[model samples]
Target: MSPRSASVNEELRRRSRERLLQATVELVGERGYEATTLADVADRAGAARGLVSYYFPGKRQLVQSAVHRLMHLTLAAALDREPRTDDGDERLARAIDAVLGLTRTHTTVMRTHMALILQHEGFIQCPEQQKLAALLEDTIARWGAADPGQDYRLLRALLMGAVVALLLPGAPMPLSSLRAELFQRYGLAWESGCPPNDEPPPRS
Candidate 1:
């Protein structure tokens, strides 16, 4: 049989890497960081144990990349979810909801991811992270930022802060409250973007 083409080989590699990343997310999120080992992730991915280190420097790095990929995919889906729109306000609202919604559903995973980012090795620079950043930047631009470049940074910081706040242990704030503040800040109507099934925040 002829050797596989270069493109085919590249596609295989991409699939392998994606499987590893996804396995990391599932294992780490379900089992927490320390409990989940590289071997476990490899096994879960049905990949060779050696392939783990070949794809990622360590479990921490692997988990970070995986979580970032999750974040990117989550946000993307929210932006294009049912009842989609191109309106700047609605898009921005969707972006906010997408992220804040994660705080509710993926609390444990995101808490661990944030802790690693804040207290440990700092931001892991990977293509997945860059993609997440680019999408957020685009969200800010779509929101009609007068200076999207600057506003993107601000938006990122705010989202990070909100996540940290939402995940704060023993004193975690309410997602509804955080959503209220974000909506108010961006002049977004409370009814926007698959709004929660709770009462609307009171008007000033």
Candidate 2:
């Protein structure tokens, strides 16, 4: 093939891949990962199933790509909305707020992430999962000033657990109260005051 033709082909392939990723995101968000099939993704993307396979090899790869893209976009938006400050407590607060805000706005994405975590076979294998873990580790290390290995691991686990609990169905605690509890547990400084909640105050 001529150089010009090869360049055009590469551009086309990139566009197709982007379309596939977008479709995957939409489908996963709407239907959850296990429910979304390659055919559904192809139909949504207006591309052939073969094309998705050509780019991603399998459904797992497609889901991984979509998750990675979603995380990057969401994390960037969260960071932009609440940029990190010099204070460690502020950084932790922002991080907690970011995660909660993301979950509140993008419930489907959070649900998909939870579904992924339950699957032992795919959870650890996906590149997006590794990237998320690394991001969590890096964020904790920066804010906590602790070793990134075990300490960050434990912190990440705690944060994720708190997130899951907040997302649980029919949880008695309100989100605002949950956010405050997280900040306090992590030793974050509250600028204004405790979050608005109907619950009674703790005994002095």
- Most accurate candidate by lDDT: 1
Which stretches of candidate 2 lie above 4 Å from their native place? 1-18, 33-35, 55-61, 82-86, 192-204
Mark the regions of model 1 whose C-alpha exceeds 4 Å error after superposition.
Answer: 1-4
TM-score for all predictions? 0.94, 0.71
Model 1, 33-77: lDDT tens digits are 889999998899999999888978887788889989989999899
- The clash count for each model shown is 0, 0
- In terms of lDDT, model 2 sits at 0.67
Give, for candidate 1, the lowest lDDT window spanning 10 residues: 195-204
User: How high is the lDDT of residue 122 in model 1?
Assistant: 84
For residues 1-204, write the lDDT of model 2, one tens digit per residue: 999999999999878887888898888778877799999999999999898878777776677677666765655455445344545555556656666665666677666665566664545454555766676666667676657778666766765676677677677346666666666677765552223344453322
